[model samples]
Target: MTERFASLMERKLPMLDRLAVITARDQYVRKVLIPMFSDEALDSEVRTAFQSGAGGYIYQVDTLNTAELKLILQEYSWADIIEGEPQLFTQVFHVVQHSPDEAFRAEVLAEIGPYAERGEIDGQEYALMYDRVELAAGRQQLYGSQLECLNGQFDVHDLKDPEGVDARRASMGMQPLQDYLEQGRALYGPC
Candidate 1:
């Protein structure tokens, strides 16, 4: 299944790449871009139409045909996309959902600590932490203060590999704290 998904992704690379460019240009789509254009669903022709600038994209499923391929890509619901990536999206969605106003601020707080300790968090691993915090925050699954403290201890040190850091940070907003710690600990850990 992974291989098939990978192959499909390869085939849809052009469309995905184009969609990414469009999404980046249009901040409105930034949140929903991942769900709408995940590697799994890219094979659907409807996705292709929207990615290619067909008619007009709609946020509503009724407007988008699970069967038809002509409908233009429309708006996206952050909730809907988060539903798709329950593990990660749920976390982010919940953080924003329950707290409504304080989500992003909380995120900054939660991330600051770990970031300080480790110096960085790779995109993928951070996604995991984001999801966890989102779930905790949204569902009240965990103590908010605990999360805040944990994130606070993180001390983002100088990037040892400036070149690599610049490359990844340029592409993605930030690196995962786990990755940074793993690398740093491996290099600097007591022998």
Candidate 2:
């Protein structure tokens, strides 16, 4: 088990590094370049580069997803991995979001909540996974912090059971929802 975990980490870390680079580059082209040069005005080479970058990032996402699926096929459970190797579960969860399996994400979400309750994983990681699973399922998010600016004002994605949000955040080592919202507004607002 130790040897297997070590090998998995060795492979995952490098792949994650490459994935981040390609994904960031792809985002830069979409968010930065497309705005600076309108879609029709982009040079062919620049356009092609953006297309290729997006394709490459998607390919990497597929590769990572397949790798994670293999890991899931193993006998390991979330608690086993979190208690033994710790960060492995978190790393897997990061790329696992790209996977199209709602059932699998739900499974992880259910399985990990107890571990988080036991302090097996940190609060931020727990909150992130919780918010992600909920949002992906088209349900309300627990943390009001996941915001996108609409008209320069930060708007909370629909939140589930908003009344208990601060307690949820506190349980997961997060600050109050209002405090997070304040920061989001300051950063994404003034409209």
Candidate 3:
């Protein structure tokens, strides 16, 4: 890591480390742990245990992490947490993006604009959240970064202007909408 990155991380090590732990549990439950339990080959009883136990754990952590992250955002700007270490943006953004509060997400979306402009955070990250906020508000998304699963097929959410979407996405360093949808389909198959 760069010197600034190391310094910032050390100063905020406790918060950042805790975020890492939360992310690990979050991803594990959704990815590896849940899948292990849901395997059709597994006994139903074991699956039930995983569902009750791990599922509860996910809810508990999500609530706790959301509260903690909200407090952190109240205390610090995104630049304070992410200016030196661009990578740290992922940790903070993951929490903000997954937050159940649409209002909070919208607030964070506004907060991120200047940082994205200054190149402190990835523009794609900003674009993703922008699309999410727009979709939540029943407005058309500009960058085509948000996708929806409609009738078991994943497709980009409605765009503000279909003709300008590719240019907007490119401005944010994102690929064409078609390429993004194709990649998602390739990786996750139709859902």
Candidate 4:
């Protein structure tokens, strides 16, 4: 090894994890812009169409490319970010969980699967990660932990097996699915 590498090994400092930087940028976009605009709000960030006459309505628009441009940059950045081998997935996970980059968060969760399964990491984190990914993918979450309600009912997309999901959850260190949902309802108002 070179002298610099030898010194690095001795000190045990993380050598510039580019993935962390990428994750940070993505996180900023998610936490700031998406939440600020409620995702859909950005669709009409600078434009509104109102019917004036029977003929048609003109759109009051300004900087229509803003949101699209931001998304394009994010997508491009992700491609480059994934090109390298990421060593600091734990850090990446922290950044992603707080951010709305659900797809990237799911990717990080997938990377953590082996560690989580082997008891190297908290199973609750693993379960939450699994739920996040499923919810992101529009699937019935396996844990049935995270939930939302519409019309006084849990808005779970489509849970796979209502009968035995708890067994699956317990294997990954989670409460029984029914118990989880009941708690969820209590906390989130019948959701």
Winning candidate number (lDDT) = 3
Write the residue-wise lDDT of candidate 3 on 93-182 in tens digits. 876776678898999889888888998788898988988998899898898877776776668868888998889989889998899988
Each model's lDDT comes to: 0.37, 0.63, 0.76, 0.51
**TM-score of every model?**
0.18, 0.56, 0.77, 0.48
> What's the CA error at residue 127 for candidate 2, in Å?
2.2
lDDT of 2 by residue, 1-191 (tens): 89987877774565446444544443454455334433545676775676567656665655555455545546455544554556655655555544556667677678777877787777677687677778877888887656765665667768888888888888778888778878756542332
Question: Which is superior by TM-score, 2 or 3?
Answer: 3
Which of the two candidates, 1 or 2, achieves a greater TM-score against the reference?
Answer: 2
| Model 4: CA > 4 A from native | 1-95, 153-155
What stretches of model 2 exceed 4 Å from their correct place? 1-63, 70-72, 98-100, 152-154, 161-163, 178-191
lDDT over C-alpha atoms for residue 103 of model 4: 60
Sorted by lDDT (best first), the order is 3, 2, 4, 1
Best by TM-score: 3
The better candidate by TM-score, 1 or 3, is 3
Clashing pairs in 4: none
Task: Report residue 101 deviation for candidate 4 (angstroms).
Answer: 0.7
User: Which consecutive 10 residues in model 1 have the weakest lDDT in total?
Assistant: 64-73
Give the 10-residue window scoring lowest on summed lDDT in candidate 3: 182-191
